[model samples]
Target: MTWNILVGGQDRLDAIASVIRREQPDVLALQELKGWSARRARDFAGQVGMHAHLAPSVFGQPVAVLSRRAPARTRSITWRLHHAAAVATVGGLTVVSTHLNPFDPERRRREATWLSACFFRTRQKVLIAGDLNSLDPGTDHSEAVKRIAPRYQRRHLRPDGSVDTRAIQAMAAAGFVDVGRGIGPTVPTEGLRQDEFGDFRLDYLMASPPLAKLARYVSVRRDEVTDMASDHYPVVASFG
Candidate 1:
């Protein structure tokens, strides 16, 4: 599961915990973990009955990965990203919790490319999940994106007034497959919709071709707790 829990879920920790406890995904990738200390993240992991790793970030927007088993290794990746990404090696799979620049498409492009190529030294199956802040190809979010008030749309579009897609394209070129593509949009939960944001997919769970082929199912989890817990919803992808 991958979710951008707004501002570290400070005010809604219980609600967030409730949703997580109910879903019970084997692995969780989280973004926008603002004000999160390693201790705080560990405590949250304990609360959820999972082992956790918090990738420390200079900007306070750290990404995290929590899993059923303790990871063998954990590392931080900050290659031109607005937020630090967390990597955990669990079993034979390498999981990456990533968050790209929320505003700059060019920076997001660079970040995506770097992340896509990072773990290729080994033939390890890789699963990347979190708020990529970009849309995949073959999905038309233009209508919803355009509804987000002109001034607030620059970051989501090119100067040509079209949705900018270079960031995601870069990742695809590196051989990453969108495991949850066409599942659904992942943002602007029921109570959080505003003029500045509309329904669209900004979060994802991507896998290397080897891992992608084993994916069994993908879903977007939404309900009362999710609506109030964060502006962005959670997504889950299953594999054999």
Candidate 2:
């Protein structure tokens, strides 16, 4: 499962912890973890009986991974502003937790290329999950995007009149599949009244072929608790 918890709001973290306890995912990926130190993340993981690896803060935003077993390795991949990937290996799978640049499509494309390269470099099954900040142009999220923020179209649309999907395409070209691509929107419209876009599908769980085959189900978690916890919703993917 993966979620961007709104800059790690203390109450939000508590809420996330509660959800984690209930869901008990094998691995949890987190982004936009502002104000969360390694110790704090570790403490939280301990409370939930998991092991945590948090990237060093970059302008207060860091990515984190928590799993039932300790990861064989943990590292951070830095790119443009407020964009990075927190990576770890657990149960023979490479798990990446990332948050891409929210406003720059071109930069996002570059970041995606790098991220995909990382996945291809390893032979282990890989799960690349996070807030990609880019949408698939082939999918019909137009109405949802319009309802959130009409102005969003002006910023995200390419000159050719397509939503910038290079980043997503990059991953697909590298043999990764977005398990939640058409599942549902991951962001909620309520808190987005002040933003450029309302509820949209911004978070994702993309995996290599091996991992994709292992996925049994994937969906967005939308309940009173998740809705009130953060602007974005949590995406869960189950593997057998």
Candidate 1 stretches greater than 4 Å from native: 120-122
Quote each prediction's TM-score. Answer: 0.95, 0.91
lDDT of each: 0.84, 0.79
Model 2 global lDDT (CA atoms, 0 to 1) = 0.79
Instruction: Give the per-residue lDDT of model 2 (tens digit) for 1-240.
Output: 998888675666778788889889889999887777889889988998999998865543888889999999998775443556788999788899998878767877887887887676434588989988888756865566566556566556666766677888888888888888677677663543346655568898988887788888998888878877888888988887
Top-scoring candidate (TM-score): 1
| TM-score of candidate 1 against the unseen true structure | 0.95
Candidate with the greatest lDDT versus the true structure: 1
